[model samples]
Target: MGQTSTSLCCIFICFMLAQTVFQVESANILFFFGVSSYSHRLPAWPLVTGLAEKGHNVTFLSPFKAKNPHPKVVDYAPRKFSEWAESWDEMNMFDMRKKGDMYKQWLILPYFGIAMCEKLYSDEEFINWVKSSTYDLVFIDALFNECGYGMAHIFGAKVIQFDTTTVFPWYSSAFGSPDETNWIPDMAYVFGANEVTFQNRLINALIPVGWDLFRSWIYFPQLEEITRTGLSTTDLPTFQDIEKNVSMIFLNTYYSEEFARALPPNMVSIGGIAYVEKRTPLPKDLAAFLEKGNGFIYVSFGTVADLQKMDASTQQAIIGALQSFPELQFVWKLRNDSLLKEFPNGNVYISNWMPQQDILSHPKIKAFITHSGLIGIQESIYNAVPLISFPIFAEQDYNAERVHRNEYGIRLEITTVNQAELEDAISKVVNDSKYDPDFKFTQYSTNDA
Candidate 1:
C-alpha cells in the first residue's frame, strides 16, 4: 500500500510540472488591426483563433469585430471607428478607375496611410490603453497600414506583418527578402515584369528606389511625427529604427498560389488561412438557377467594387455582352440588381452576394469572368477554373497581367473594352485550352506557424 501511494504521488507531480511548462510557453499577444477591409481581416481570423486555441492571450484591436470570436480572444474598437470606416468604404472606385496615372499605386496608398495614422493616433484613450497593456508580440496588417509599427514601439514587442498581398519591393528591401528582379516582377507592375525589354528592366529597377525615397522623404517621417507626440516616454526612437526590428512577416500567399520565392527564415507564408471553413450548401434559389442552364459562368470584382456605382459605360458593355450570350447561364455578383429589369436577359442571374467557394468548386462552373483581384485569382486557381479578366485598377492590373502571361486566363483592356471586345474576350477564355497548371499556385498552404 505504501509503494502504490508513492507511485501515484510521483505521477501527480509529473502532471503538475507539465501543466506549469505549458502555462509558461503561452504568451500575451496584441493584434493591431485597425480599419482594414473585410477581405484583409478574413485571412487573419484563423491565425488569431488558432493562436488563442493554443492558450495564448490574444488582444485584438480593430475597427470591426468578428461575427464570432474565440473564447480566449479579447476584442476592442473605439465607438467612432465603425462610423469613420464606413465613410472610407463609401468612396467611389469608379471615379478612381477612370483616371490613368502610373504613379497612382506608389503615391496614392502612402497618402491613405497618413490618413489612417491620423485616425488611429487621434484617439487619446486608445493610445493610453495601448501604453498600459503588455505584449509579447505585435501584429500589423501591412500595405498602407505601416502606422501599426508605432504601436509595437510603444509596447516594446516583436513585430510581425500579415501581408494581404504577396510581398512588395519596399518590404523586400526593408526586410532583406529575396528579390529576383530578372524573373520575379514588381507587384505593382502590370502583366508580369519578366525584364523582356530594356525599358521594362529599367522601370522595375527604379520602381523600388522611387518608393524607398518617397517613404524616407515623405511617408515614414510623417508617421514618426504622429507617433512621438504626447508620449511621455523620454527616449523616442525614429520609425525607421522600429521598422528594421520586425522579427517576422506572415504573407497571405504560399507556394501553390504564388511562385516559390526565396524568402528568409523570418518570412513565413500562411496562405488561405481564412479559407478554413468548408463550403456550405448553396441557397436553393441559387442552386436551381445554376441547374436550369446547360453551363454557367461566375463574375465578381471582389467585395470593394460597389457595382451599383460602377461607370455606366462599363455596366452597359458588360450587360450588352451577357445579353448576346443567351445559350449559357450567367451568375453575376452585381450588387445593383435593377440592371436585371433595365437590360433583361433570359439566361442571366444576378445577386448582391455569392458563396464564391461553392460556385467555383461546382462542376457546372465553366469559367470565371472577373476584375482579377488577388483573392479572386486565388479562388479560381483553387478550383482550377479558367479566367476572363478585366483588370481595372491597382493590383487588379498586375493580377490580370499575371493570368495573361501564365496562359491560365485572358485579359480585356481596362480602358478600351466595348461590347464586342467584352464578348470576344469572354468567348476566347471559355474556349482556350493552353493554361499550364504546373506554373500556377494551387496547394492548400499549411504553414500556420
Candidate 2:
C-alpha cells in the first residue's frame, strides 16, 4: 500500500486535528457494526463498556445488544439488520455445515462482503442513522465489513478497526505492520513450532506473501466497488487510499503471546480485557450435581457448534465413552437441556447454559473436552484446565493445534471419531499422568517462548 499523497496527508492532518480537539472536549465514539457473530462481539464489550464507564460518549449503531449497558453508551436499533441476521443465523445453524469444506472461499468472499455492505447501506434506518450522526472516532468491526471504513470517512471521523482475533498479515499490511512471518506463522493456518524447522520456517515465511497477493488481487477489487458505491458522489481518493489512514487496529489476542510478530504501532491487543474480575457463581443444581461425583470431565463445543447436529454414531460413541466410567462423572454443555435424555447415561449430565469459567475454577473439574473455540481456549488456559481439543472447522482447527502444540492438551479428529477413540482419549487424559499436573503450563509464556 502506498502512502496518501501530500494533499491527502494535509486533509488527514486537518481531520486528525479537528478530531483531537473534539476528543479533548468530550470523547465521542461511534461503533458501526452488524451481528457478525456472538464470539466476535464478546471480546469487544470490555473496551466499549469500559470507555462508557470512564465517561466517553459511546454510540453502538446495531442491534446485537449488550448486557447491563452503561448510561454513557447509546445503542441504536436496526430492525432490518436484525431480520437479516435472524434468517442468516438460522440457515447456518441448522444447515449441514458446508463452510468448513469450502477451501475455495476466495471466489465468494469478495462478493459476499460487498453484498453485506450493500445491504447495510440500503437499510434506510441505518443510512439515516449514519447521516444524522457524527463522532470523534469510529470503531468498526472489520471482518467483511470494510465498508465501515468508507462510512468513517463520510462522517469525517478517525477510523479505528476493532477486531476480536489475532492480528494478521493482511491487516498488518494496511498499517505498515511488518510481515514478520519467519517466527510468526499465520494465525488462520499456523505452520507452528516447538522449534521452527527449516521447511516449516520457509513455508511459513512464503505463505503470507502469497496470501497478501491473493487478497489484494481478489478481495480489494470488490471492496473498491462497494466503497465507491457507498460514497455516492463524494470526490475523494479510492477506499484503498482511505484505508491506510486508519488511526489504529485493536486485536483480541495478546501480541507477546502471538509467537513474535511485529505489528504496526497502531495495532493494539486487548485480548480477554473484557473478562470481569469476579466470576458468577455456578448454579446450585450444577454445583450439587458436580459434587455428587468425585470429579467430572466437562464437554462443550462452544455456542457456534450445535451438539444436536452431531451424527448419531458420534453421539453413541460419546455416550459409550461416558458410560464405561460410571464412577467418573461427565457434564456436557449443549444448546438445549432436552438433549440430556438422548444420552441416557447415569453419569452424564447436560445443560443449555453453564457458568463455564466458574465451573472450571472448581478443583474437582479435572479436564475440559472442547471444540477449541478461541474464547473457550482462553478460558481453559486462564483457569489452568487441561483440554481435549476436538475441532470442527476453521479457527477451531487452528486453535486445536495451538492447544496441543502448547502441551495444554491433546487433539482428536472428529471426522473419523469412534467409540474406542473417544474411550481412549478420555481415559488417557483422565488417567495418564500427562494431564495430572496440567502440562507444566507456565513453561510456555512470553518470557520463556
Q: What would the C-alpha RMSD of candidate 1 be, to one decimal place?
A: 3.5
Q: 1-449 in candidate 2: lDDT tens per residue?
A: 24558779889899988876744456879886653655666677667777888788888865466555667778775777766666543433222333344224323444556767777777776776677777889888876567676677777899888876666546656777776766766555554457578887787677667756866776666656665665464564666777888888887665433455666678877665655447777888887888789998998877666766777777777767777877787888877676556545567778877777787778888789997777777666666678888877545656777677667788887655788888888777777786645454442332131
How much does candidate 2 score in TM-score? 0.82
Q: Which regions in candidate 1 have their CA more than 4 angstroms from the true location? A: 1-24, 67-72, 191-195, 230-232, 342-346, 436-449
C-alpha local distance difference test of each model: 0.75, 0.69
Count of clashes in candidate 1: 3
Flag clash pairs in model 1. Answer: 256-441, 256-442, 257-441
Error of 1 at 320 (Å): 1.2
What's the lDDT for candidate 1? Answer: 0.75
